[model samples]
Target: MQQLLVVGDIHGFPETFVELLDVGSFEQRVLQLADLSGRPGLRGDNLHDHLVKKDGLQHAVRALRETNGPPCFGIGFSSGGTALWSAVKEGLEIQALICVSSTRLRFETSPLNIPTIVFWGDLDPHRPTEIWNDAVPECCKTYAGKHHDFYRVDALAPNSPLRTDIGAFIESVSGLHSGGPAPAR
Candidate 1:
């Protein structure tokens, strides 16, 4: 069976957001970074400051490494995505990656070998630049909202367009619709 890992943003995974994804069939694992400790209210500069001071991303990468096992599909939000990307670079096995609003990836220049996709809101000021988008191995999609909008409680309506697109992408990457194995990008 396929394993699916979900990494939360700095604010951690909200219950509503968790319910938005379709992971019923896969063996799933969820990570809430040590820095946040399940906190969900931090925002703006406070969030950035706290993460930087706590070396949150590095901790997250460590946590991922400890849990590392067979190749799996990964979904990460914001800083969590950066941690996963870093973990992949450090040799944690992953078949594919889907990152949402992971603006920090703008600094990554090295190409990833596996299939990967990224999602960001068009209105998010911190969204990655054209150069990063162009360099990524797979698709980069933009939604019509600000940063964090896609995962917000109000935006997680069951059939929201963002959720639909994300679900479709997961299916395609995991080969859920096709009997064949996932593709190598």
Candidate 2:
């Protein structure tokens, strides 16, 4: 089976986020990347500072490239998405990308050629602006809540529309439900 790379937000993958995704089903086939130091519980501005202001993003890209050498499907949350994006630009092999609430992408002028999708809440003030959306309107999806809704258990119940959509995307890209061989990485 093809592996999936999951990158967590600055807060890391909270229990709620993990539970909502029922990640255990594919736990063995998933490679999860988080804080640059592999430390837990880093949040808010401090984590942002470490990741962006301190060259941690480059470190993360390097770590990602070293940890997962083959092309694969990826899901990145917030700043983690930015890291994944950078890694891809810097030659990390990734077939597809799903970025949720990666607001910092607003500054990205270059487009990624791989199959990619971005999700953010309608109320997220920091979401990419019209220009960014215009660059890839079809790849952008908006939910009804605010930023971080994807990390909230209550906001993303297993049966919720957002969860269902995300599951479908994963299945489509990974061919998990097709009974056929997944595409070559």
Candidate 3:
């Protein structure tokens, strides 16, 4: 079975994280990254820098290294997505990446070796579609909604279209078991 590490936005763990990851196939397991906020040592000043670099990516690495398991998959939203990519950029291994509403994606010269799927709302003010398109190519999925629209707390589950897209994307990469899936036409 595959394990998925869910990284939430900077606002902390979004309620949608659990429900959204629940839509995956049984072969995949879900682990939502802990919201270190509201905790004693992690509460104030430089929180972003602290978690993003020295302290942040470790969570994923620890999760993957626990029990000497295989490289776990990643699902990140907004800043969480940034953390996921940062882990990869810093040499942490991930089987695949599913990023939603990510504003900044550090592009390197080497063609990305991992399979990546990016989802940005058509109405998101963060970055234009062209940027995401250029970054992820055909692997980007644009929905008829906004940044926070992909997942909501009160709903019984995540949006249906998003669910289907996520499930399909996960399955699409099952073959690689390494990098991201090819762009879907």
Candidate 4:
């Protein structure tokens, strides 16, 4: 598999995000890029232009396009998640996408066919389960926590279902050899 780019949140500290990569066993396969602006974690407006500027996605595509490795699989949370989507919308072409708590995606229908997974909390105040259900249907994974609970903290649990599922998804996507567009999940 190629490098795993952990796009830190605009509000997230670079140090904390690096720690998260270490805990997730992804530190070894990282794509070190320019310093990310803003804080880490989700807070709506606080993250957006500061975290992923309008051309950030395009920049990542150009930067990684010449890399000597297989396609990348991105894991984003909250605002980071939506930014990844925007990147895909801008034709970033990641191998796979796993997003959690990217609220307000119920209105986005830009024809994403990648091997995508969208996690929905049972008690999310932002987007309801039905919304995610209607959006990805077969690709959505439902968790037993609130919106905030879907953060990397929940993923840190050794026996967490979210962690296991993410591992499996990454493995599966990494093995893909066809350069064709990802099929619907």
Highest lDDT scorer:
1
> Per-prediction RMSD in angstroms?
4.2, 5.0, 5.4, 6.4
Using TM-score as the measure, the top candidate is: 1
| Colliding pairs, model 1 | none
Models 1 onward score TM values of 0.79, 0.77, 0.66, 0.65
Residue-level lDDT of model 2, residues 86-141, one tens digit each, is 88878878778878788888888867878777778888888887678768523667
31-118: candidate 4 lDDT, tens digit per residue: 3233332132333344455334555434544544443545667766665566666666666667778776766456576447687777
Q: What lDDT would candidate 4 get against the real structure?
A: 0.55
What lDDT would each prediction earn against the true structure?
A: 0.68, 0.65, 0.57, 0.55
TM-score of 1: 0.79
Q: What are the clashing pairs of model 3?
A: 114-180, 115-179, 115-180
Clashing pairs in 4: 10-38, 10-39, 11-39, 11-40, 12-39, 12-40
lDDT of 3 by residue, 1-185 (tens): 66766666655545343445433343344333444322223422354555555565466444433423567777776656766666676676877888776665534233246888777777776644465476553377666655543544312245466665666677777653324344353
Candidate 1 residue lDDT tens string, 61-126:
766876756788887778778788888888778888888888888878876888788888888888
Q: After superposition, how far is residue 85 of candidate 2 from its true place, in Å?
A: 0.9
Decide which is better by TM-score, 2 or 4: 2
